[model samples]
Target: MTLVARIRALPADLDDLAGAAAAEGFGMLGVLAREWVAGTQRFAMPEEALFAARDGAGVLLGIGGVTRDPWAPALRMRRFYVRPPARGRGIGRALVAAALDHARGAGAAMVRLRAPAAAARFWEGCGFRPIDDPTATHGLEWPGRG
Candidate 1:
């Protein structure tokens, strides 16, 4: 299957986005569902961007975004989730590449994410390393630093 990732405008349906998050065990109907729910305005900036992945038929395969990391001076890759049937198809990698590319273009020195334990391998495979801070859920720093 051919997957295309792009930095398009966010979908108007919050429910759909929430459903995608819920599929990955992230709760849907809550303030903690996704950062965009709480900080919708943050994504308006060009530096803070959102990307969506769709199949040739236009099915939503996955969604991810990059925004200012609240805990540090870095861009945070947020709400990354892929549909069950679309796993292991390089969609996640494509999304991460888009986010990192955006970060680099925005003059960010690093990128970070607090990914779940289930996605540790994926993040590690993408060249993100765990940080030493215990307060972080599970942090990964951008490996390609200047």
Candidate 2:
């Protein structure tokens, strides 16, 4: 059966999701947790926000966030991860769509991310193209932004 996920702005809790990500050898989620607890990098900057996807049973399926790039005046997509079991369920794509929509709504003309080598195809499939920029490995410009 296909599962439905509810995507929304992150809440104050994500320990379970962080643990799941660690089990799969992904440490970004743990960093997200620590930074969240420390009151740093909460994605609270203007035009920035974090998103979480939860299954019908309220289990975290994935997470992604957009923030202002520290080195460039552009939006950066970060801390994106989908639980292993939740792969192929459209959860990751949904998270990306949500983040992109948020970025566009906030007046961003483009979005960038440093995708891991293994995730190159996925990011490309999501409309991001590989780039040589130091601040990001891939970028996507909003259509008609010019």
TM-score of each: 0.79, 0.88
| Candidate 2 steric clashes | 0
- TM-score of decoy 2: 0.88
Best by lDDT: 2
RMSD vs true structure, all candidates: 3.2, 2.6
Q: After superposition, how far is residue 137 of candidate 2 from its true place, in Å?
A: 0.7
| Local accuracy by lDDT, each model | 0.71, 0.82
lDDT of 2 at 49: 81
Pick out the ten consecutive residues of candidate 2 with the lowest summed lDDT.
Answer: 1-10
Runs of candidate 2 with Cα error greater than 4 angstroms are: 1-13, 143-146
Q: Model 2, range 43-143, lDDT digits (tens) per residue?
A: 88878888778787767678888988887778999999888898998888888998898899889888999988999999999999999987689999987
Report the C-alpha lDDT of model 1 over 1-146, residue by residue, as the tens digit.
Answer: 65655555555554675676666678622332344456644466777887778878877787777878778877788777777778889999998888888888888877778777888889989888887655354444444654
